[model samples]
Target: MTITKKTVIVTGAGGGMGRATVEHLLEAGANVVGCDLNIAALAELEENPRFKAMKADLLNEAAVQHIFAQTKSEFGSIDGLANVHGIAQHATPIEDCSLAEYRKIIDVNMTSIFLTCREAAAYMKEQGSGKIVNIGSVSTTRPRPGLQAYVASKGAVESFTKALALELAPYQVNANVLHPGPADTSMLGEFTAVGSSVDDTKKEVFESSVPLGKLLQPEDIAKSVKYLLSDAAEMITGAVLHVDGGRNI
Candidate 1:
């Protein structure tokens, strides 16, 4: 848990899991840059000296560059990165899933990780050390029906992270993926079929699908992200951590 004074970049910092990670890191005494498309949700932390809220679309290459440059200038180094921003695909038959819909999911969920990780690698390589934790989904391992695009996107995340781990290993930079199962975030409801009751789906489908019989909380993921970014996990890389309450089992 020795993350004091480290500088970390957290994408999707406005979302449920992202905000929780930001808060957890700040509590651990790290200088945090919380980036998202809309950072209004993080306004409450504007007063915290350790937190910097940056609003930028990760798909834009220029904006992504600025996020890293500004982080380096402000924090002096890019020590860790937690990519938590992602989109969920609604349960839809392949016949109804258009190319546009599938591409959008891939761009948001996978391309964004590419952009951020590219920036992180450049900085972390120069510094000779860093950590990267990409947030994947448990669905990649145990996918539900009608979620082909979502599963494919997250599957790519896990593979990409493992490749990054090996590439950065020489520089002492660790890269890993975290797959959360049936989280209790707003994104959970987005996975329901069109016209399906969100609550019923959560209780009967998503919740019951887990062996632990409970949905994961945002804080649960935040804790794991913090550990991955901390010295406690210094030797860990190319690992897929399942924080999904036995859902993958």
Candidate 2:
């Protein structure tokens, strides 16, 4: 089966990769539901009849619940969900990290995912099948400095995806993690920039580390997320698909 005619929800729909994923999903003829804290970006997507926009903070269970309610109310049932909402750290050493700040990151990046999965799983369980493509990062598998909270949360995302897949597999609800390399995303400005300026120094290091010798683009990630959500990946559950340009190699 193709993605066309299916209904999908994308979190963090306001940003770079999130917007790209929404666009690709639309092109595939899927009914798309986009949610973001940025009301303006969500408004832009509402212009398309195939696209529905909802303002939500995934960290808020009520807000996320409303997103599902809106989707069900408007598009019937959801066929897929892409958990893409996340934030980057400013390279604060773990030694300097605050408990409150760490908790906030975990809440935003990990707890919110659990909330979405909880709601989506219920809907998909009733439908008997669905796809969940969660976005993780290479940092989860690879060591990165001064980003303890973000990295730990991403690692949890990877772990949670596997655990959820195990629980959802009996019903054919596929769950998987997409680990991206250092992509050219807005998040990278902090990871790759140097000494009070946006520099290529970090990018260079990342580029040299990757076997592909380059930074990944948002489209690369979008394409992978699309395919994972499609029927092509029907049998691929609980697997961590790496889109990090051979960085793990």
Give per-residue lDDT, candidate 2, residue 18.
Answer: 92
State the TM-score for model 2.
0.95
**Tens digit of lDDT per residue, candidate 2, span 148-218?**
89999999999999999999999889999999998877777866423644455455566677888888888
What is the Cα-based TM-score of model 1? 0.99
Which candidate has the top score in TM-score? 1
lDDT per residue for candidate 1 within 175-212, as digits (tens), equals 99999999999999999999999999999999998899
TM-score of each: 0.99, 0.95
User: Model 1: clashing residue pairs?
Assistant: none
Please give the CA lDDT of all the candidate structures.
0.97, 0.88
